[model samples]
Target chain A: MDRKNIKGFLEFVYDFYKSMKAHEITLVYEGEITHQITKAFTSLTESNMAKEEESNSVQKKVFHVMVECLQNISKHADSFGSDDFLFAGRGIFMVSRGDLEYHVTTGNVIENSKIEELSKILDHINSLDKEGLKQLYKTQMREGRLSEKGGAGLGFIDIARKTGRKLEYHFLPIDEDTHFFVLTSTISRNE
Target chain B: METIKIMGTDDTPTVILDAQNEIFEISGRSLPEDVTAFYDPILQWLDEYSSSPNPKTIFTFKLVYFNTASSKLLLDILMKLEQLHEAGNNVVVHWYYPEDDEDMQEAGEEYADIVDVPFEQIGYTLS
Candidate 1:
């Protein structure tokens, strides 16, 4: 291989390893986000989190957020047309443990047309305080109809409620018709 | 009516609806991949029980965790119980949460506020 290509590959590996060590990342999965994969990810996370000396409440919060994040990938990830990637839904999921918090992050591809709706939802969620989020969650639960995919449209709201933190998200343009979406939520170690 | 008992799975909750014993309980995690398919049977059982509910029906929810999709079905279940209670049957809901989980407790209160059914909030430490 060319010297530049070799250098780039080595740099990618080095950066990945550095980040894993620096962030204390417990788990990382980057592949098709199928139902089976989600289950396996969760079970693995449950065992890993159990190993840590954390309260049951904190463990539950992290687990719940992780589940929602993985489900989002499975439900929304758009298929890439390349034959090399034949998975049903492709995404990246990771969990990192900080000194006083746990962070869950996920990324997936979505149609560009969905960007506006998703941006609005995230903006609304970011605007709300804890009480506002709770109220909105209840209202959505009582009045909102389930989506065609069977989601109650309360995933983001529930995440906000559970974490009591603003959701960090971004949409990067991938093509004229598609964009990559990334979302992150954090759970504090303290009650 | 016949008892509707469903064993819990890694992704779904355990459900026991015994009309004879007057015990209705759903406990454990509930985030099934196919929420509609998972909850359809329970809803049908509730529909059947509505016709001839017991004198006093106490429905208990001891869910450790549930997804957003499952939340919709939970509301449907609570609404059904509300209808049953309004029809002059004595129906009450007991929502149990981990002692420190204010989120679940608030969820119970939200459901109680939306539905006319009486709800009792119970907090217990998980063993």
Candidate 2:
């Protein structure tokens, strides 16, 4: 609240933004993931990619993955238990372009109780080959029931199949009862 | 029955089902937030169309992008068309993709693989 403290905080924020820019992140959004936000984000991202002269195919893949990631946060993000001031469904999402691939990253706080199930699912998906993932996607599509949140339990598998890459995920414990879940998926420019 | 026509939006596809003209088409992006709400009427229309389909029902898909939820509904629509075909109706699906988009072509192929109906993969450039 004091002048020197405010200066230090401003410098910290500047440093964070600088680091993100250095990584070639074209977009960085951190806040509540509302439906309006999702719609606007995808539209902005598509136009941004178009200006970059990315191929149509790659842009489609990036947009699809972005939708899934943003929706995942909106539907499943948990409130931080002790941090009551933080809004529910708050999450961080970013899209960065690398030399050969575009990386989509998202982070949200989740209940610690959900970590085991989430980890198991991620591990199972990561263990599959491309063919295996395709098979899984088809089978799930045919038989999986839609969740109350409208997910068909196929979002992750579809992402894996589209990217043809292992999904990278991590769970960082924020407290005894909550953890922040981060997911990263890459779409190869050559593909 | 009257034709069913729904205009496309940012998150929903344009649907044109004309029994009298024997033409059916779906175009644009389909990542609707409420997949069930957006697709229920289309499914119901298909059910009604199956009872009295045209001699040759040509279904065309020119989708730029769709999400996982829409993917499920798409398969459902295709399966309905397959049923119509199985019941001795002439059904053909024309799937169009941008010339540079191999992924869309592959998506059409995947749908073609799953159903017994005839499929045509068409690629065109946007001018």
Candidate 3:
């Protein structure tokens, strides 16, 4: 612990605290995503929202959106170029509260080959209106087959339908085989 | 057949499906990490019950919150009742929701629209 390095670390910590406070972020975690982990995050967020005096319906919406976002990472973690220990089984999850809505943001790695297909799914969901999303949701549930991992590919549509807001996302290319996918789902707080 | 009564946790719902005592209900939150595995028994129970169901089966769903995965499982359960109804059984579903919760109410309506089972959406206060 050199004096100069210790001083820099404290400054970094202080800066992070300030940024988090400014954003009104309720929870943040960067690690592996699992069922147990999702349960913990959602439970903690539920408590936090309760403290904020949110209505029961808004609390339900936020809780639902958070579960979907976290579960997506655990269920859909890409296996490309993940041999690197740092990249394998790692993800970033955060929840922030604003005046009009609560935001659930997640970041994870994805195979390059899956980018186009994934993009199309998100785009298609975002392109539709309320009724359209409802139709798609029913159709997907009735006809869609569960993946090898048991996901019926209904998370996004359900989130979109519940929140009544467009999903915001983008992929940052890390190399040729993998990209960092970041998604943010907003739940309006009018309740 | 033995009844299925599993206590609900923060993630899983409390399920009560006892045929002998005239009680059949599923309530509370549901978001198990493994939906297929957790719901397999319930589905199986419904399957077996369909074969030798009570003359008049009145199942109830009092789910407070459930994920999309569980949504599919709910449809499966409702379809079982629908099949029972089609096979000369009087099956009615009472989808219960908190009085002020539109999402839960609408959820019941959606299921009612898709399935042929007689549905009665009942709104009650959360005591």
Question: Best-fitting candidate, measured by DockQ?
Answer: 1
> Model 1: what TM-score?
0.92
DockQ of 3: 0.65
DockQ of 2: 0.65
In terms of docking quality, how is candidate 1 classified? medium
Give the C-alpha miss distance for residue A82 in model 3, angstroms. 5.9
Clashing pairs in 2: none
The positional error of residue B118 in candidate 1, measured at the CA in angstroms, is: 1.3
Interface RMSD after interface superposition, each candidate: 1.1, 1.2, 1.1
Preferred candidate (TM-score higher): 1 or 3: 3
lDDT of 3 at A52: 81
Encode model 3's per-residue lDDT on A119-143: one tens digit a residue.
Answer: 9999999999998988888888777
Q: What are the runs in model 2 whose C-alpha is more than 4 Å off?
A: A81-87
| Model 3 chain B worst lDDT window (10 residues) | B49-58
**Pairwise DockQ winner, candidates 1 and 2:** 1
Q: Candidate 1 regions off by >4 Å?
A: A1-15, A82-88
TM-score of each: 0.92, 0.92, 0.95
Candidate 3's displacement at residue A52, Å, is 1.5
Error of model 3, residue B26, in angstroms:
0.8
Candidate 3 stretches with Cα past 4 Å from truth are A80-89
User: Compared with the true structure, what per-residue lDDT tens digits does model 1 show for residues A69-152?
Assistant: 887887778776667855546799989888889999998888888889999999999999988997898889889988777777
